[model samples]
Target: MALKKLDKDTIIAMVLVSPSILAVLIFVYGFIAWSVRVSLSNWIGLLPDYEFIGLGNYLGLLKDPRFHIDVRNTLVFTILFVGGCLFLGVGLAILLDQGLRGESFFRSLFLFPMAISFIVTGVVWRWLMNPAMGSRMSGLNLLFDSLGLDFLVNKWHTTPNWGIAAIAIPAIWQMSGYTMALYLGGLRAIPESLREAARVDGASEIYIYRRIVLPLLWPVTLSAMIILGHISLKVFDLIIAVAGKQVALDVPSVYMWTTTFDGQFYGRGASIGILLLLSVAVLVIPYLYQTLREESTT
Candidate 1:
């Protein structure tokens, strides 16, 4: 009788979750398998033509100069955006940790930008960083002129060669708050007595942070890096909102968009999509492994 009840409960539990599990299997894994099949085919036209040209699209991208530029832009954007977020996030977290006057108000002000979408940020910053000169000079250029600080004015996202790097500005601005929130949680989890103990031992505040606090925040930092890494890898909508598909600021996601949809190179687009998926997986899988391993050990 007891065994029957246990089996019945197990069946009920499976029945409750089976629909969601089946949905994920069919919609997520099923679509991924379909995309992989599409990527390997010779389907470049509007219609589906699965001629089985394995790795051809990937190989072509290797020799493509535009693709090379895309890769380089991605590298530059990812480094600056991720690094800036980490730096500003941890700094804001440490500042708030000090319990300054009107801390709640300041914390809200810092995190307020995170509430807005990246598209909104891109649009706003585009005007603020408008690169036009002379009569067309407005936004930051106009403001800088008013303040008599000509050197402070810049072409921003229009700067040649490093234009893509400027794109990281809005990204970092929007995300640093989220990173700060993560680090703040990590900082709070650390017991206050530990800092007191270090102080009693004649350690400076900076020494305590370097040796104790920062070490404990490593997990948080790693988590933020993975999140930001994947985000930087697949940046699309934000770039569109800011730069409007210019070649100088192009990244893989934008190239993929134009290549697949606008250009209708279906197979090539699928390949780009697949490569992007792989890049994100490379960041995510390791984090998942570490998290699961720690959980199992505990």
Candidate 2:
């Protein structure tokens, strides 16, 4: 059969999207390939002189003490941030779905942080968490001081994992609203008749949600988890901005950044970058496969 001729408007629309398509392929895939190549080289600075080091960079990365710490920090951060966001977002969405009076107002307030840049969020949170200069001293401190509770302002970001929490709080605050919106849409997709029938059948609110609502939301939860994992893995601005050269709190992304800029170890930095890319891919691939399998069965 002969193919129909393409319309002028259809051809124009394809041309409009072609630049974006080309941009993603060139910038994203091209840079990824370049970084992988650099990771296998012994390059330094802007010099092109490099020996084929094979897996030398990978071996050294495994041996580095900081690499281990950064990995630990990243995993810990991913877990807490993703888990906290899901729990908080889903919980809030459920509450808001119950016909709250100012639901729109509350939603706007919650989403405001997501609109702010990560750099701005980090800077603002840094000011708010400083033991001496933060709201701990200025706002809560004054109120607590009157009650003789002066122990809370000593050092907020000095503890090991606590510092991680300190940095993640702002991130969670920013992104949880977005997750809430996702859950809200999922919740809205549920039929009201089913909920009413469940209530008539003597199912408690908790049981209705636990059995009926939660299972149906699995697809949304999986998608949100993948996105949150990716964001958490790539988190560098908040950590670096708040901590500022404190390697004690560095995650892998921040480690790669500091290695390239401060330590001037381009090959090692590229290697770290490649490692992080692999880590995100590892987390994503299994989930993507599961999703695709479920879709096929359905």
Candidate 3:
């Protein structure tokens, strides 16, 4: 009778969660499998007519210098992007958590970016960072030039290192807010008594935060890192909108889109997509495993 009741309750709980579970399985897992299948087959154009090409696509992807650059660019972007967001986000969260007045207002301001779409963010940043026509150029650049500083107007997005940073600005703007919100929530969840005890012990604010708060916020950091990593990996729309159709700014996702559609290298494009998936898995699986293990132990 006890086992039966337990089983009944389990079934009821599963039923309650089944809708979300089913949705994830259908949309995420199913699509991943389908994409993998497509990658193995040579397909292109309006309708996908798949021809089995074994590992030809993969071999081509390996040799493509553009793809290799895309991979390297992606790695660099992910590192810098994730690092900046977390540092800014957690720092902002900690500052805001100090029982400052107008907390909600500041919180909302920080979160405002989360409300804006990345597409819009990219467009705005593109205009701001434009070589000649951006508002920043006309507004600030003109002011600088008026002061006889013509060097500052010399094309912000054309330089190599700075060009990548220009693309990263929009991404950071859109994501940092979301990350700040997460860290803020984590901060609020920290026990008030712990802070009080630290205060009583005469621990400096920096020391308390570094030793106590940050250790606890590790989980939040990990979660945010994983989420941002995935986002960075699949970044496409922003790159395309800002950089354009061909692979000039050439991240893997943008490059893959062009190779498949523009260059008619469907096999190679699919392989690139597969490689992207692999990169995501490489980053995510370990993070998730550690999270899971920690959860299980705790």
Index of the highest-TM-score prediction: 1
RMSD of each: 1.4, 3.3, 4.0
Q: Candidate 1 or 2, higher lDDT?
A: 1
Instruction: Please give, for residues 1-298, the per-residue lDDT of candidate 1 as tens digits.
Output: 9999999999999999999999999999998898898889878879899899989999988998888999999999999999999999999999999989998788888889888988899999999889999888999899998899999888888898999988999899889989999999999999999999999999999999999999999989999999999999999988999989898888889998998899989898888888889999989998999889999999
After superposition, candidate 1 runs with Cα above 4 Å error: none
Model 2, TM vs. native: 0.86
Query: Candidate 3 overall Cα lDDT vs. reference?
Result: 0.80
TM-score of each: 0.95, 0.86, 0.81
lDDT of 1: 0.92
Ranking by TM-score: 1, 2, 3
Q: Global CA lDDT of candidate 2, please?
A: 0.84
The models' CA-based lDDT, in order, is 0.92, 0.84, 0.80
Candidate 3 lDDT for residue 49 = 62
Residue-level lDDT of model 3, residues 59-103, one tens digit each, is 777787877777777877788789889988998898888889998
Error of 1 at 273 (Å): 0.6
Best by lDDT: 1
Better-scoring candidate (TM-score), 1 or 2: 1
